[model samples]
Target: MDNQSLNADILILEGLKVTPRSSIAAFIFLLLMYIFIMVANIGLVVLIFMERSLHQPMYLLFCNMSVNEVFGATIVVPHILRDLFVSDSERYIHYIVCVVQAFCVNLYGGVCHTILMTMTFDRYMAICNPLRYTIIMTNWMVVKLSVAAWAVVFVMVSILLSLTIRLSRCRRFIDNAHCDNASLFKLSCEDVVINHAFGLSYSVLLLGSSTGSVTLTYIKIATVCLRSKTKTINTKALQTCATHFTLYIILMFSAFIIIILHRFPHLSDHRKMVSTVGEVALPALNAVIYGLGVRYCIFWYRSDTK
Candidate 1:
């Protein structure tokens, strides 16, 4: 096939092979899942903004995290749901749409990790140095950090997409339901050593830094817990850090599992399902954790006011 011919207008998504009966079930389930994700995450953000008392640095960061969850899930779940109802032959996406989706999906991931890491740092400062927490984590500082996180992820995703877009695509079939950096670049007939090198370096740097930050923060928190003679400090630390840690673990575990699944081409469907579930479910789970934590705090806040 000639390069021009291979530059088709659409790319086939061969991952979501659903029977007529199964398609209906999957569509309903995903629709409900996406709805819940939107409500939970958006609801948290709205509540934080409405309540004046919840305008602390912690809640502000939670608001940012929830917004990020919404961003990530929106980039993926609707597309998957749409693909489910379509016939096998019609299960294709536009060439430009695919590239845009790939960019947004990867941007979601990079930003997600950055926000989570920022939240961890917030928790560390709040717990390890209560006296200086307010001084260090002012609203201005949170805004700066949030802006920096998005800016960093935006640049990284742009670089990765630029590399893929430069490649001469000689294929149009992606074996998964969604477009991503790996699947998009693999469609090219040209050598992709640079792509692979940059992708690996990107993942390693982001994941390693985020993981290392979480680890060190928790170790410091643990140290504080051990020497603290007061139950009040330990309880406060647990309340502040528990939800953030839960979210960190869930996101990292889902991400690592998907990465491992990609290594085995034979489990394309398994990989597809895992990837879809991760993208959809992780946001919902994050919102739920944050909602519960916020509820607990609100209970105390209300009690104090009463």
Candidate 2:
């Protein structure tokens, strides 16, 4: 009994040691980054809600994106900040808490991706089928689509979390700073073949389906733009889609890099840093990129004052 207890304590200490101690400068840098992300994302959400002129579909979707950013960053950054301030002895989080945090973070992040894809489709329809845009993308349809996105996210994340939490973490050390879902699986001593298979299958299905849909929509939109006789309409369509295009590229590339890095464990530290920047820092820049790059946003702002 004494030996078993001592082994358990050792495992717990090993898990605690996974997160490296940060210097004062590193702590301050992380704090500043968190604050910047929070302020920028929250400020965009507020601006969209308050500005009556910005109540269009595009802006509404932007607001949702902003909200998701706030929720997603909060899930990771608060724990990171706390870990920085506290010692390992004081930093033990309950296994249940870790699982819940991982689930929520993935849920919001997935929802954000789905919403952005929907927004891209919405833009495509509006630009390519202007006369039928209203009839097709009705308020009712928008509401239903948004609700369905959330529903899918909830169902997928719930299943993933259920499977993850059932695994016994006998070897408690996690490689990453936070209790990431994949890292948690790595720490588990139980047979995780089922969990790994399901996770990969779901990810592939969801990502492939969504990417295909977004791609088809944009292809049709581009074709329409090419054949259009009206240069003004063509310009407007390009302007409207520019921000969404940039967002899609950023998200898809970042997600791809992260998954690749996670799978290929032998990748160097520089590669991991790139992935982190893609996932975390890129998200923080979304609002600024969209706002500055989209002419419609500027037009709405200027016209509102007049």
What C-alpha lDDT do the candidate models reach, one value each?
Answer: 0.87, 0.71
Q: Where does candidate 1 have its weakest 10-residue lDDT segment?
A: 1-10
lDDT of 1 by residue, 42-160 (tens): 88999999988788888898888888888888888888888887777778888889889899999888988998888888888888888999999998999998998899999999999
Model 2: per-residue Cα lDDT over 68-124, one tens digit each = 777777777666656665665555665667777778767876786788778977888
Candidate with maximal TM-score: 1
* Alpha carbon lDDT at 113, candidate 1: 92
Give candidate 1's whole-model lDDT.
0.87
Worst 10 residues of 2 by lDDT: 9-18
TM-score of every prediction relative to native: 0.95, 0.86
**What TM-score does candidate 2 reach?**
0.86
Q: Model 1 segments beyond 4 Å from truth?
A: 1-7
Best-matching candidate per lDDT:
1
